[model samples]
Structure formats: C-alpha cells, structure tokens
Target: MAPNFSDLVEEARLSLQALVDYGDQLFNPTVRLGVTGLSRAGKTVFITALIHGLLRGGRFPVFEAFATGRIARARLAPQPDDAVPRFAYESHVRTLVEERQWPHSTVDISELRLVIDYQRPNGADRTLTLDIVDYPGEWLLDLPLLAKSYQEWSAESLKLSRQGPRLPLAAAWHAHLATLDPRGRADEQETLTAAGLFTDYLRACRDERFAMSLLPPGRFLMPGGLAGSPALTFAPLDVPADGSAPDGSLWAMMARRYEAYKDVVVRPFFRDHFARLDRQIVLVDALAAFNAGPEALHDLQAALAGILDCFRVGRRTFFASLLRPRIDRILFAATKADHLHHASHDRLEAILKRMVDRAVTQAAFAGAEVDVVALAAVRATREVRMRRGHEQLPSIVGTPLAGEVANGEAFDGSTEVATFPGDLPTQPDGLFSVPADSGSFKGLSHFKGLSHGSADQADYRFLRFRPPQLDNDGGDTPYLPHIRLDRALQFLIGDRLT
Candidate 1:
C-alpha cells in the first residue's frame, strides 16, 4: 500500500519542526519572510546578503546594530530539507567569495532558513528563526489569472496579440480557433491544432518578454503531455447578459474552466503554502523600467497594479480587515541600489515610491499594511571622494566589471585624486544638506544620466544601493544592526518573540 499524500505532508511537517526548533524562544521569534521581485530584481543578492549577515553573527557593519538590539544573541544552525528545503546560502556564498562572482539569478522556487538566538528587551533569551523562500517573479503574475479560464485567458491573450508585434502570431491562432467547430463533437485534430496555436501564442509572449501582468505558468501552456488533452484545451467565453444564460457559449465553457483552474491550482497553493507566511519582502527593479522605454514603464505599472491586487483581501469595512488573513507586513524594496551613487539612492527610492504609491494606497484601503525600503543585496563598492569645482560629496568608487556596462556603453565612476582626502562624512538626515567639504569629494560624484540594459541581457550589473537610515532619538547606539533587527522584529514578529 502506498503512503497517502496527507501522511507524506504530515511527515514533512514534523521534519520541519526540528529545523524550526533550533533557535532560542524568548530572544528569537519564529518568523517567515517571503523574498519576491520582478524578473531581474536582485532578490538573490538580498537573500545572499541576509544569510551572510546572520552567518557572520551580524558582524557585517551594515547590520551591526540590528544584530544586537532586542537580539541578545545570534547563531547559524543546521536546517532541514523539509518544507521547500532551505535556501542554498552556503552555495551562493561560495560562488560569491571563492569564485569572486555574483550568484546566478533564481529560475525556480527555493527556500532557506536562518536560526538566530537573541536577547529581547525584557532580558529573556530567545531563538528567532527566519525562513526565506524565493520564487520566479514571472510565476507571480499568474495568481490573478488563477481566477481566469482557458477561453477567458485565450480571448484576453488573443486581444494582446492584436497590439504590438504579437498580432500576427495571435491572428494565426484565432484563425485556427475560428475553424474549429465548438458545438461539434470535440475533434482531437481540431483541438490539437488549437492547442498548438495556443502554445505558439504563449511562446511568442515568452519571446517578447513582455511584462504581462497576468500569465498562466509557461509550463501549463506547453505541457509535455498528450495533445488535445483536457489540460491543454480551454474554452474562454464572456459573461452573458441574462442571468440564466447557460447556453454553452464559448465564454461559459471558458469561465467554468477558469474557475476550475483557480480551485484546482492557484487556491490550493495559497491555502497550503503561501497563506502561512508571516512576513514578505517585495523587490523592485525601477532602473529596468526607466531604461526599457515607455512600454516597459507601463508594463511595470500594470505589474505593480496586479501585485497590489493580491493583498486586497475583503469587501467590507470593519469585518473584512479582521477576517482577511494577510501576511501582516509587506516590505516593498527597490533592489540593486548599489549600482547608483549614494547621492541618488534616496531619489531611486522616491522614484519607486512614487511609481507604486497609488497602488499601495489602494491595497491599504482594502486592508494590508505596506512600507517601502531601498536595499542593495550585495555590496560591490566602497565610498569614494569626489570633487567638482570646489564642491565635494560622499560617493562610491570601484573598478566596475566589464559586464556591468549597460546598453553597450562604458562609463567609469573612477577618477585620479590628490593625496590628502577628508574622512567620509555621515549620511545626511534630510534631503539636500551639503557637507561642508562637498568641494573635496570630487572622485565621489554620481552620474547624472540614466542607463539601462537591453533585452538580451538583464541582471548583468552589480547594484550599489543606499541603506535605509534609522531615526535615533540621540541615544548612544552600541550596536546598529541589532537595533534595526530588533525594530524589524518588533514590527514583524514581536508578539511571537516573547
């Protein structure tokens, strides 16, 4: 007799507990953080940096205070292969350190766990477990379409085909669908032709790499299965005018299938896996949009609109917030801030915040709390001095790799400087407070113009980002990273921390 799926799930769940149980309870809270981003956003770097921070026991200066605050202790422990399995942080670290190269971007869903022992404010020793999971950004768009059907999907896709360069391919598929007799006995040959056409349309979408807000997983459209099978066959029809209009129009059949896809595929995954998440970090690549031309910007907006819609849980005013089980706090972070000079880091965050603010507001109106943070997952450069006509500013200097060049262009952020240079100044609190020696920081100036990568190679540049500054009420801070971590813990998992 074979083991039932439930039994297997139970065993896996039990195995995960051992891994989850490694941290000290009072100081460390069991928290789950979701890492998500658009196709080329630096989620990998963010995750890698986070793992490095934890592994080094918060030795990294970036998170030094956070490691000590509310967290009296921190450590790395063995993780289990249960659940989705831990993220291969060590493997990524080796790639970055041993090979002196950045880790390749993620292609599929992956998971990693970091167990930290900490001391909470109340003087209790506790263990905090951070479970990080990553998935392809492309797959995220499909969440909305889980509610859509084959016919609906097909019709919508068909419409997309008419616009841009996608029209000819879609027209061919539409012509094929037009020939097939929907009312006639389902002819395998006709169905096969339609599926083939559908597959072609999907392929075209993939090839164009259009930032579509919704797409069924590519695998589903081009399944390695029998042709004309029920899985590949979809009938997308429109909603009828009459309430009782059940006469199987292509729309009705498609609608039914769409609902089935949701019930069978999307809903189960959310209910079983995603809903359990406690924290989420959404990574955005704003630079990509500014460079992709107007269409890409529109696509970015559309994608943001779609992503925000997911957290819009309920309809009612009072009861809805209480009833909707959201992942609590969502962090919308601009990834790869490392690529730009420090001077423009806030501007990048502001740009992203401006771009997604409306959608975020709408999501909040529907009942989810969201905040934006600017982050660089990997640190690629060091602060440098720049001077221009007696004005100096804090800037980063590094020998950028050849591949870091964008759009077949090469511009260096380096400069020849005199022997005596002033020490790096503190980050400005408010916008536009020029340091007294802005004139001396000549080598630290940022580029004024925007640069973008072409379609062929995305995620090629090393992103340098400005880290978020914490508001201190003039207290002597012994540990910086621990304080940030504690604040984050308080906001995200404090209730569970104690």
Candidate 2:
C-alpha cells in the first residue's frame, strides 16, 4: 500500500525542522533536555535547584566544567516556544528556599532555556543553550496507546484493572461498563457518565496510598486545559473480540474519540516535545512504590518499560532523527534521597537500576548511554545521630510538613525533629519478587519480594520533610543543597561542554 499524503507532509515538516535545527547549530549550540517523573517525583525541585546551583556558581567538584571554573556563568534566556508556558522557576524556588514549602506539580508541558557561557582552553568564550522541557509522567504512559487500537486498549485496561489493589477501586467503573451495551445507539449522557466513572476509577488508583504509575490517557489525571473536552471524554468498553462498531453506536463513538485523542493529544506531544530531546532525565519516586507494596512496584516497572519504548535511543544522524529524533543520553534518577539516611542512598540507586534494568538494557543495546542516580535535587534534611538507650541510631533531622505524622504525632511544619527512617534491603532484587499467592497481574510472578529489613519482609518508612532553610547571602539566587546533582550534570551535559 502507498503511503498517505498527510503522512508524507508531516515527515517533510519534521525533516525541515531538523535541518533548520542543524543549520542553527552551526553558529549556536544547544541541547534539549527533558525533565519528567510520576506525580510527587519532584521534577520541579530538580529543575529549580539545578538552575539555582549553576547561577550561583555553587561548589560542585563532580561537574567538571562548573567546578574547575571553566564555565563562566549560566543564565536563563527566552525559551524557544512562546506558546508553551515558561517553567515557573523563580516562584517555585522562592517557595522551596525562603518559605520552606514544596512547589506545585507540573500539570502541562513547559519550557525553559539556559545559556551557559564557558571559557575554552584556547582563550575563547563559548556558549550553548540548555533547553529544559518539563511535563507530567502520566502523559508519557500514553505512548503505548499509539501502538494499540481502541479495542486492544480496552481489553488490556480491563485486564489490568481486574488485578490486585485496583479491583476494589474500579468497582464503580466496572458497574457502569456492565450497564452499557456496545451495540446500542450512542447517547451523549451515557458517554459522559461512563467517561466520568472511568476517570474516577483512574484517580482512585493513583491516591497517595497506592501511587500507581501505569495510568494512561494521562490527561485524565492532569488534564491541563483539556478537561471536559471530547478528546478527553472516552473510556474503554467491553466490545467483543471480533465486534465491529456500527456508525452512531456507543462503540463507534468511543473509538472515534480515542483516535482524536491520539491525533490531538498524543502525537503533537511526541513530535513537538518528547521526540526532539537530545538528553533526558526520568525521575522516579521509588520510595512511594515501596510504601505501596509489591503490586505498585510491579506497575512502576511496567510503566518504565513502556516509557522506554517511546525514546528513540540510538546513534542517529540529525537527518535521521529530523524524521524521528533519537535521544543520545538518558538518566533515570531516584528522587527524594533525603527521605532516607545517607547509608541507604546507594541502595536506592541500586534498587532503581533494578527497576529499570530491562529498559536500560534496551537503550544501551540501541547505542544510547544510560545511567541511574539517587539524588535529592534540594536537600530537605540533614543527618543526625540519636542516642536511644544502648544503641546510637542514625536519624534525619528536619521539619516535617504540617499535618505530617510520625508515631501518631502531627507536625506544625516549624518544629524540627529527628526520626529514624527504616533500613532498605541490602540487595536490589528483594523489591522485585512476587510471592506465590500473588497470582494476580501478568508477568508479575517473576518479581522477587522487597524485604524491608531481611530477605523476607517488605516495607519502606517513606516520610515527608519540609524544604530546608539556606544560609543565603541575600542574593536573588543561592546555591540549593543537593545530593549527587553534580554527577547527574556530568552525565547529562558534560560532553557537550568538552
């Protein structure tokens, strides 16, 4: 079959953009860096802290360019896309640094461009644009939808919903599905009601307690400005395996809207935002998965795998990627290392590596460089030693966020206290094991149990701490405290400077 004209036109447009980018690079060098993570993964903090650190010329022994004084200065410039919202860096940083409160989560895709001026060995000054793009991880989960038809998505979603932890939450949505007849004529009210129920089910599964990572139609959770639009109003149906939707039928209506979502919501994002990246960072809230138990852990792994598939991880020419951009380097980071003691930081990185092992393998095999790091973009706590009876316990001292509880005691957000966070397993696979009785989700049986203390127990005492106060010089910006951020910078853009 011959290719469609619209497909050809899109290919040509993308290729032209790539050629333009290539031509611009002749005089102006730039790197598009993508920042994303699941809800509460601290994407905002990472970006804010990274910028603050560079602008302040912070002490970073690992980031060679900055540490060695080769990089003269880093400053923000006008972002490339005027249509896209600029990342609220100043506001977010002030809240995190001065007010000691966490910033708001990202609901829509935003952009920020940083121009770094560095001194060269040849006595010349050089500069490059670091374009940071931020978006919700929920949206990334929808990448898989491109490869699936409406019927396929419905069947798979139903299967996933029927499993552990999700079954109870999906009760209402399931009830609504049971009442609907796919072959019946499409009714506007019925369509809206089903979408509402299904959306509710997705939200319920993502409650803080569960922290599920596999939810799709990502707009359902962080709809941005698309809330209530027909593009966001479709839900899966129980269409028979071989069923065909007659025009004006409920199934037909849903299928049509699903296609529109892919065209309007998914494709544009993939082309304009995601696919163009030169390097990327995927932040993971690993601690949340531990708290949510084994099922959530498995879901996170699957989500990462699905997301990995979306990245074109390989060595490709600019022309090749103008058609389909290939990410040259990708970093998967375990965020919120401050939630645990310093000793567990390595363990956290190891566990994150295990979680994305398969995806990492795929990326590396395709010739892309990949790394995993455990970091707190903004260090929110300090290590303390507490003498308890005969044992000196390692603890973290920080102000707990208001209403945050420890041992049934609530914090006022201003009182500082030391609390002993529980230990993580010495080995990584402990979190991947699935017990014999958990014959629930597919491919999950291959998981090994996450032994909280031993090889047999499962637990993680994940806690929330308020952002720490900085002894600032009263400048417009100050260096934000962080863990392993220098190493992350080295991996992300070190080569570009060299």
Candidate 3:
C-alpha cells in the first residue's frame, strides 16, 4: 500500500524539526493579551492603532521616544515564527484605505501575531513576538463562571434574572422553564422546548447586538450559524431544593452539559492559553456608561466585579510549565480620547479611576497594579483654530453618514467640524441625576448611539477591554504620551530596558 498523505505530513514535520533546531537558541515568551470590554468598547480600533504605531517607527507625541522622552530606535519586518498567528492587519488596513470607511464591528475572536524588533536601552537588539487575540468583549464575562458547577451557575442565573437591569429575555426564559416538572423523567421534548425559548432570548441579544453588554456565547453569536453546535447549547444550572438529590432530573442533564462546557471550552482555553499571560490592558468606555441609563450603569459595575475576580491569581501548578502569576500591573484605558479635547482627557481618566477604584482595591492582594488613561487609536479629527488669534484646535471633516446635515451648507461632508471637551470622565457621584441633554438617551436610543462610531472618529462610540499586561519589575509606572503602544509597552513590559 502507498504511503498516506497523513504519513507524508508527519514525515515532513520530523524533517523540519531537525533543521529548525540548528539555529541559535531563541527565547520565546508567550504574552497572552486579553482585549476585553463592554459591547461597544473600542478594542478593534485600539489593536489596529497599536499595530500601526508599532509598525511606524517615527515621532509620535503619545508614544515615549517616538517623539522625545527616550532616544530609541524601531522597525517592522516580516515575522519569522510561523506559529505566531497573523492579525488581520492587511484586511483592516484595507477597510480604511480601500473602503474609505470604518471596518465592520469585530464580531468574533480573531488572533494575530507579529514580531517587533527593537534595540534596548542597553544597546542590545532583540525581537519581541506579540501574540494578540481579539475576541468579542462580552465573552470575557463568562470566563470566571466556568469554574462553577451547573447547579451553582444556574441558581445564580436564576437569581440574576429577577434583580439585574433589563434581563427580561433571561427572565422570560426562566419563567417558561419553571412550568416544566424537573422531577419527571427526562422529557426531551419539554427540555428542548424550554431550551428553544432560552435560545430565542440569546438570539434576540445577537440581533440587537448593542443594547446590552450581557452577551451569551459571544464568539458563537457573532457568526449566528453556530447555534446548532453542542458547545453553544448549554443551559443555565438549576440547583435542587429540599437539600435532596435531583440526579436524573432534567436539571441534572443540563448541568452535565454545563460541566462539559467548562471542561471542554473554558478550562483548556485558560490552562493552555489564558493562565500564562504576562500582561493585561483593560479598555473602558467610561463616557458610554454615564450616557446610558441607571440600569446599565449598575450592570456595568457588577460585570466589572465578575471579570476582575480572575486576575486574583490562584494556586500555581508545577507540571504545567506555567509562569507563576506575576502579572502585577493592570492599565484601565479610557479609549476614544480624541472625541474630546485635551483639557477634558484628564477628567475622563479620573472618572475611570474613580469607577474602578474599588475593583483595583479588591484585587490588590494578588499583586495586580492598576492605572487609568484616556487614549485614541486613530487621531481622525485635529483641533483647529476657531479664530485667527488662537492656535489650531481638534476637528473632524467627515459626513455623519454620507448625507447628513450639521451646521447647514449642502453638508458636503468635507468641511471641518469642531470636537469640543476632550476626554470624558467616568460618571461622577451625581451623574445619574444630572438631567437629560440633547445627546442623552431616553430609552433604547442609548444602544443606537453606541453602535454608531469609529475608533477615534466616531461621534459617540467607546470600547472597554481587560487584557493582562506584561509582568516585569519595572512595568509598574504609567507611560508618558499615554495614547500609543510604546507608552503601553513601557508600563506593561519595560524590563528589556533598551
């Protein structure tokens, strides 16, 4: 019999491994970054901009030596390691260049890898491989819950259904499930029926997309066709009452599925990928929360608390080859600072600091450090002079949608429009009662506004993220020119010292 294709491929791998081992031993550090945020948080734009800034080795005010701070050098060349995944850089680049438009919202988890070469402060040259993973912001919330049993998780979900803001869909699903007799024989029909209603609620979430940040199976929802997959069909855990056994009940079956989900989906992702992170960058859209209703505001706080629990470093395993959880620094960046003016950027940063102050304080026991910053990935609008005497001010010269009116004229979408304030702060103590303004939302309009902007250019769009920062002794201080990647690098991984 002829040698099979699989056999040929296995033979090739052996041959390649032998040749590749001949090179000088190269050290590889897998820095897994989790770019997390609420629904509209500007993760895609921030990542895209970070990649662009790193690639462009020139003077950048928001980046350290790119302009002044430190005398340094930079360059971007083809990455060597085939295992390092490639970011959709070319496609994203084309979205701006070819389409002359913002790219569609990042709907699922996409991985990108790049090798950035630079000379350290000690004059030694090195190549740092960055393995970047971008996933839907909402899925991050599900990470912590993976450790819980289905009964425990289901009970919590049931509790949350009655209390959390705007969880009508989840509430209705639970109400329908209550009608079924849990103690009866496994009625596949009734179970499937209840599951169908719950699935509908999940589907509704996908359809609106921007309404609430509480997304279900976030990665799966974006593609829509994955609903049939077993991984996406998990039911919330339902704990038994009377302190008695409910094994062999419908709830038990669903609980089993939930366990499978945690074992098959969540554990591997964390142990193999997430548990080894060296750095984290959490993107926050403080302004967006202030603009949303009280319910959203409350939900945001609960969501943050849940996500931060993961960073509190648990026990370390010897056999895993994992680095002891040394991720000491965490940067909570308030993205889309360009939407406001320079004066208000600090205020925006301050607001974020205030909002997450409790979260940081709680996680401090794990050696995690925290900082808040206001940033813009792409500086779409520039502040120009309103009068002859003053200096140029930040302004945008684009259409609202192709044909929308602003200050009259034919609205050619070419005239420069002023962008005031600067950065936006987190909601102040009394922001809820601040009274409605023209831009404030009354009902569902808030969700509409969130879905309507680009990274830096959008009139009203911000992103939230929570990726681990690179851990190093010197990676604690905040970076100067806080908007760019070089600044992020200084704060997240500056031990290289060059």
Which has the greatest TM-score? 2
Measured by TM-score, how close is model 3 to the native structure?
A: 0.71
Question: What TM-score, to 2 decimals, does candidate 1 have?
Answer: 0.65
Sorting all predicted structures by TM-score, with the top scorer first, yields 2, 3, 1
Deviation of model 2 at 405, angstroms: 1.2
Better of 1 and 2 by lDDT: 2
> How do all the candidates rank in terms of lDDT, highest first?
2, 3, 1
Task: Give me the overall lDDT of model 2.
Answer: 0.84
lDDT, candidates in the order shown: 0.52, 0.84, 0.52
For TM-score, candidate 2 versus 3, the one ahead is: 2
Error of 3 at 412 (Å): 10
lDDT of each residue in 1-498, candidate 3, tens digit only: 356675366445543432332222245533446665765567776776666555644335544434443434334335434643545776765564344455566665566665655566566666666656665556666676555556566666666555534366566777877677655566666666666676666555434222444544453455344555555555553555323337787766666666666655565555444554545677776556555554545455656666676663422233112223334566777776655556667766765666677888876665566666777655444444342235343432323334443223233434444433323333444433433322343333322222222334443432221121212335322111224445665565454334
Distance (Å) between predicted and true CA of 180, model 2? 0.4
Model 1 C-alpha lDDT per residue in residues 1-498, reported as the tens digit of each score? 356675466445533543343323334556666777766687776777666654554344333335446555455566633646556777876666545455776666677777766666668676767777786665566676655445456556655556553556467777776665444443455555665666677565544244332345433542433244454466332332233223554444444544555655555545545554556777787655444333444556667767766653333222332333345577777765555566566666665676577887776675556777666655454555556447564545444443334445554433211111122113322212323213232222332333233223333323332222323445432112221222323344445555
In model 2, pairs of residues that clash are 430-449, 430-450, 432-447, 432-448, 433-447, 433-448, 433-449, 434-447, 451-457
RMSD in Å for candidate 1, one decimal? 11.1
